[model samples]
Target: MVKMGTFFGMSLGAFVFWQSMDKVHVWIALHQDEKKEREEREMEVRRVREELMQQAQQRDSVA
Candidate 1:
């Protein structure tokens, strides 16, 4: 009877651990995707600013 109880307890603990680990994995994936998107947006902003500055410089030189 004690052995049966021990087996049940161990099985429950294993299931709980597996579920928590799955949640952690999902969270990490979401954070990584967000970081990638943020970096892309920042790069785009910098490119646009550089282009605008170049245009302004060209106009000044022409005038």
Candidate 2:
């Protein structure tokens, strides 16, 4: 009976540990995705700014 109880306790503990690890894994993945999205947005903004600057320069030269 003691052995059976011990086994059940260990099983429950292992299950809890696995659940915690899964939560951590999901959290990290979400942050990574957010970071990538943010970086892409920044790159797009930079590209647009550069294009606008070039257009302004061309207009000035023409004038």
Candidate 3:
């Protein structure tokens, strides 16, 4: 008696694995870029609001 194991064809397995990894890489990259842009926008908004508030306080103090 002999025992045999099942194996996938090599090229097909490689291609399917590569495709799945590529998709995941693309998704992660896009998500990271989106988060960075959102953070930058929020920072800019905060900076502008702070500047305006400081100016208002200075003017009120001088009055």
Best model per TM-score = 1
Tell me how far candidate 1 lies from the true structure as C-alpha RMSD in angstroms.
0.7
Tens-place lDDT per residue, model 1, 15-37, is 99999999999999999999999
lDDT of 2 by residue, 1-63 (tens): 999999999999999999999999999999999999999999999999999999999999999
Please write out the lDDT profile of model 3 over residues 1-63, one tens digit for every residue: 122222445666888999999999999999999999999999999999999999999999999
| Poorest lDDT segment (10 consecutive residues) of candidate 3 | 1-10
Number of the candidate with higher lDDT, 1 or 3? 1
List runs of model 3 lying over 4 Å from the truth. Answer: 1-8
**Local distance difference test scores for all models:** 1.00, 1.00, 0.90
Instruction: State how far residue 40 of model 3 sits from its true place (Å).
Output: 0.4
Q: Which stretches of model 1 miss by more than 4 angstroms?
A: none
TM-score leaderboard ranking: 1, 2, 3
Candidate 1 vs candidate 3: which has greater TM-score? 1
Model 3 residue 19 CA deviation (Å) reads: 0.8
